[model samples]
Target: MLKANLALLFIILPFTWMISGQFLFSNGDKILVIITVIALITTLFKYGFTPFKKNIINNQYIYLLIILSCISVIYNYFHKSDIINIRSVLCVILYFIFIPLNIISTRVITYSTLIGSIGAISFAFWQKNILHLDRAVWQLNAIPYAACCLILMTAAIILCIIYKDKKEILTISILSAVISFYAIILTETRGVLIAVFSIFLCLFVYVFTTKISVKIKITFITILITIGALGIYTTQNRLIHDTVQGFSQYKQGDDLSNTASRLAMWKAALLLIPQQPISGFGDNFEPAIENLYHENKISSQLYNLHLLHFHNQFIDTTVKHGIIGLVLLLLFVFFPFYILKKTEYSKENKFAIFLLTFGIIISGLTDVPLEHKQVFTLYIVFIYLFLKKTHSVK
Candidate 1:
């Protein structure tokens, strides 16, 4: 009975983020989170925490990162720089526990991820066709929703290549990729588009350079690029026109575009970083900006927006959590690369995980993917899932 409950928890964890927001997520995410956490704790008690060896050091960096996160949470709590929510902080800190608690194999991840992708993609179709919604957010935050679509697209592509022998599955995977790519374009999420397209471009180059037959390679490249070109043409205004406009506006010194606004935010955040270089102004964004405004440090443009993060993940963390937070965040992100580099794995698996992680990192340059709960959970889930199976807790 205990084992069965644990298995169920493993299966449901991924979809918590994939289907979040009003349409399908709502209170459903909270319920899933509750059950998963409970199951994790119960299993830990029953198993006596045998996942780890006696004080052995393997993934110490992960522990350090968690400790730093907890410290920041506590520091913000007593100091009251901006605002502090102990409940949420505890949840973030305890996320590490899930790594050790989940004992399921790679197959569990495979099934759960596929189910989550299908549900999310299905939800996207419902929003677009049934509701006739204009942007097709799947009731998710627009930017993050687009990010999810891109991730699903890449996952489908990976499945298509890996399961090439399975004709039915390959066909379904191709269809899924098409739907995801279409949804990504419809949303007009520029940052995620850049990230996803870059990965595909890399893959395109790889296939061309490989030993594959000239005929097959040419056919594959032609089809993929043709569909991608269609998406580009449809999204020309947001993808091309606005970007060109942003550069022009920036040069004219009367910057008013969204890209210009984000660049301004990054500058403003960086300026404030030196003021509280060590500990930071706490996690409350408004209070920090308020202080900047009082001192005439922030411009009226940035002051009005009252952003939580500077649109860039690194600078965002640095402004609120200080240098320590910035370094820890970087380490946490790059640490996975270290594991992936050393691990013995299939090329497809390595490339798939790299696509996911690299896309998130690139997307973070324009958006704080780690700060948002959904994206944050997405990062944590993929990192641990991609960890080597031999990275034993015992």
Candidate 2:
């Protein structure tokens, strides 16, 4: 049983994530649900619910999010609003699916991340260089594809620094990071560029807090600088030109460029959030945007863009679920840091937690990642696995 679960985690889960999108999330949920049910029944037949109870007690935030989501589901049901919000938040329940398994290894998780990163970048190159797609994507929307690659890239780098003593692993991990970053640039999801900088800042803070040698710290810094330089050099001309043109077009009121559309969406969301600051629109994001359009609060161009969720996660949450949901989302993301301070996990485990959590949060600023079922599952599953390790260490 242990070996089977390890292989599932170390092989199937990571690879599927890199190459597939909706199928990974929807079918992945079904597979995990089956595993959780079987695990629960077998455990109940022997040890009863004590193990599950203990896990639930330890991870209160997950349940809180679940409870909040249930309320949203009910509210949306009655109001005839879209209940898609439930799909993403309810993924937190799958966190429990791993609690009964003892083979959850940070080393396995790190190596699996490397394998997935390699696969994602390779798949992306095939799409761009061979198939000749406009943007390199890991078989999904460019936004989430870039987001996942960012997580994988940063994870590879952090793991490389953590296991720097292992020469072969370090070399592979560095290669994984480089190729994964190159994939990100190819995707051209400009919003995730902020997430790239946010991750480096996190790496710097982690280096200073640890007792590692100065040489390793410097090497990490050098790697980050090289990656940043590579990104800038590869995309400098288009990035600068498109951004300026987009801004100029927006100011002149003849804009439908990428930057302008996002700004318009943000502006519309801001205007609407104040009206429903308590419970929000409750999955009625499209209708609310329509209302803004009818009232002349937003441009017809933006309204015609047919945005389902505001590009910004914070604003999207506030608009859809109101301020309360926004707070819960923040708590869910930053709660790991609280655990990190309270626990004595090793440096690698700690950085893993930090990198993954911040990767989602920062990228979310310019994209509503939590709106996607897959991104939600990915975040909760990995965070719990890492946190479980800390719980044992504690």
- Top candidate on TM-score is 2
Instruction: State TM-scores per candidate.
Output: 0.77, 0.81
Residue pairs with clashing backbones, model 1: 51-393, 51-394, 52-393
List where candidate 2 sits over 4 angstroms from the true fold: 1-57, 61-65, 79-99, 136-139, 166-172, 204-211, 341-351, 389-394
Clashes of each: 3, 0
lDDT of 1 by residue, 1-394 (tens): 9877765565345334332331236444455456557655654665545544422246543564456566656776765642222333344334444434344443444444455566666766777778888663446676776676666677667766666666756676777677778767766788988887787787787678767688979988998799778877888899889988887876665436778778778878877888889767665657767887788766676688767668787788788778877777777677766776776777766766777778888888888766655555545555554554422221
lDDT of 2 by residue, 1-394 (tens): 9956554444334323422343224365555445445544554555466656666665755665666677667767665553344544443464353344443354555566666676667767777788887763345577876777776687677657666777766777788788778888877777777677677777777777778889977877787778787787877765677888888989988538887887888888899888899878876667777788888888888988777777898998888778877876787688778887887778687778878877887888789876776666566666766665532210
Tell me the lDDT of model 2 at 360. 88
